[model samples]
Target: MVASQLGADGYDHTLGDFTAAAFTARAREEAGWLERLSTLEAATPDDAIDRDLVLSQLRGWVALASWPDWRRDPAVYLSAVFTSLFNPFQQRLKPEPELVAAAVSRLAEVPGVLAACRANLDPDLAAPLLVRRGLDQARTGRRFLTRTVPSMVRDPALSARLAEAAEPAARAFDELVAFLEGFACGGDWRMGERLYSTLLRERELLGYGAAELHEKGGAAWASLDERMREVARRAGGTADWRAVMESLMDDHPPTLEAMRAEYEAETRRVREFVRSRDLVTFPEGEKCLVLPSAEYTRPVAAVAHYLAPPPLTSSRTGVFFVPFTPDDFTEEEVRQRLRTNSRAQMPSIAAHETYPGHHWHLSHMAGNPRTVRKVFRTPYFSEGWALYVEKLLHEQGYFDTPATELAHLDCRVFRAARIVVDTALHCDDMSIEQAETFMATKASLTPGTARAEVSRYCAWPTQAPSYLTGALEIDRIRQAYQGSLKAFHDRIAGAGGLPLGLAERAVSRPGEGTPAG
Candidate 1:
């Protein structure tokens, strides 16, 4: 019963137990068994499995668990934690070594938990243990993978094999632990070349070698720099780009009151603009709010981040987390940052983070009939759609002022530089020192800013490349559609929104015709 839910690929196991709980009580009761059974069922075609229903349940499960607060337990939150850790492109502002260590210890105990689950078999005893074990692995895996190498080393290929082999859960457990231990002991303190390369490949799924990715990133950096200079030249900026950026960062920034007022005003204006323009209908589940950034994230905190609403319930409000950097800058500097985070950009940001970006995408996926599609989100698809929204707004003339346009360009330059820095660091072709220099020189970032950015790239790896890679793919799809359809733009708007995979499939298929409303 459990095996049927996993589908043919068995990649569904990686999604963990949280998502499986949303279907029937039986699913929640035996999520692990269900997942295991699903894998077995996939390998055995004769098994009577309801793939579509299982997929729907999986989607609902993910939708319910997408919220950040879902993984409250250190043991349970392992997967997301490790996923974030291994992919340098997704590092948190502050690294939590202690939390990671605790998770790692828990992961070392997974075999016992699995044994307990197998012994019980009945839901009354088995379900709780299975769920706990899943959470434990997720939490521990996240910490171990991010903080050290043990998690990956213990069982690199076992996960795939386990998905293939039926029964012998004990063997699967042992293999996983062995792989993790070997991975941990294989190298020095710093993640060496092999681990870095493996991580990059695993995260990106791009099939490109590290060296190739580095070269591609370098090309993108050069292209973006030339474009930035051209934009500056047209704006009549006499100073060098760095000097110009420094000049923009004033000594005294706006007060928190002023900043809040500006954000609120912009939010209202943008909300009205999108509606007046007849952009896709904003879902009722969408909600927006403003909050100060936590103390830990202050140094690297951006002007704001949009917290997408939860999937289980319609909490329409999206959170806009703004860091209160009171002591960091003066009133003038604050005002400059606030101005950059302007009303004109609000609609664009909203479009990216809420309306047609994360919020809209997740909402639609959550509501979709296919559960697998909803639970299994690829960063390439998610981030790519958000980045595409930025370009979409620009094409529609959203940047009405010089300052607004500059801000938009600034963001583009930042993302382009991220691709270069991420690829360069992991490939070992460019040292941390060299990456920092390139960021400061080419991206017009300050030394402090460059250092933080480089650290993030080094820590997380293939994530940075997703912004440009995803956006470019989306752009190609849109162009292909426009070539065939007279009203391509209207068709997209009218169709509500297309599923990420469906869009990719349609674009990739040779004779699928063009995208339609």
Candidate 2:
């Protein structure tokens, strides 16, 4: 579905083959492309950078073939199912009938996909936590197919067609859930130090390895911890940052509706703030919609998530999904969810996920003429920019109040913790239990949230660290920049979500635009 939307023609009507042979063939094909790219000569500076970006991505694809995540991770198939099906509904790039037809076609393919996954996944190689997480997602997938999907289409015939396709799809998910429930996961989740190091150096094009990244995270955590302590002292005349952070949550909106309204308002307010300050340029025809998380995404949704517009489409509208407190939640659970998304923290989240963060940065990325820049974004650039801008806003006094400053610091501290936890988990330095404990204690996340965070790290190695690693690298670039802050921001944003190494090169040169398509 993503490929279909992204101009990879002929994939809209059916799910791609996910068999072992199919994956082996795809890997070989990517390797061939890598070889072809190596033979090309760049005619300009931008072309050189674009070539390097494409090379790095292809290297990642070729390298990952040896690891074969499909054989070890059930979540990979779950992610495929959700992303392929859900994106069409959210992006809405096609007409209603077309979108519904695509969903129905994909839904019809779910059984085969799951059967292939079952055959490919080695019970001895799947980690218990990963399997459990997959089980949870499969249950949620079942609910999404049966309940939410039918209600999305307006036309009765299309809706009925979707519903018909959904029934067997939900059953497929049920079989997956049952399969996972009965299994004993014997594999370790760790990618090991070598593969983790390779991903950092080769895939991300970073200067350092996993160990260095972990060390950097530790240093950053210490710095942010002190900042949080100082801000807590100023916020309520207490050096107890944790206590102050807890206090801010009590000031949240009374209801999720009001909470979402606050996020919408903050998004608008932050956009205006950026405009007034002449911050990074916004792309043409860009807008962001603040709305509730889709039913399918609610299982794995963060407090705030930014869904970018499909780059192949003309629309530059981004959706900021703030999940509602679920109706099934106990009162305390509802309050906990609301408090985690506190009033004081919404502005920082708005800045991180919307204006001058994901929405603004990604809008520029979507507008890039080069398809490589538009399609192959590293989290190191995207997540990094979002995180980097949060600090930029704080330094510029966007978090004017002591409460908001404390809240922002708390988030920074959490990202810093992520650097540590992510490295530890992938490098075999921490167990899943220990990582969850570290998050709950060190980052002050609730138990449930902490488990969710660790589970994500286990499933997707090196991703959690991208938030801080990218931000810190960008900060290094900014420290040496000679231009005005706004100019620096524009230069970086104009680089279009390249690897940070490429971004630094782009920022250093004068008058460089996006690489020509």
**lDDT of each model, Cα atoms only?**
0.46, 0.83
Per-residue lDDT for 437-470 in model 2, tens only?
Answer: 9998777566767776788888888998998889
> Estimated TM-score per prediction?
0.57, 0.95
lDDT for 9 in candidate 1 is 31
Which candidate should be chosen as best, given lDDT against the real structure?
A: 2
Report, for all candidates in order, the number of backbone clashes.
51, 0
RMSD of each: 14.6, 2.1
Lowest lDDT 10-mer window, candidate 1?
A: 182-191
* Model 1 steric clash total: 51
**RMSD of candidate 2 to the true fold?**
2.1
- Candidate 2 has which clashing residue pairs, if any? none
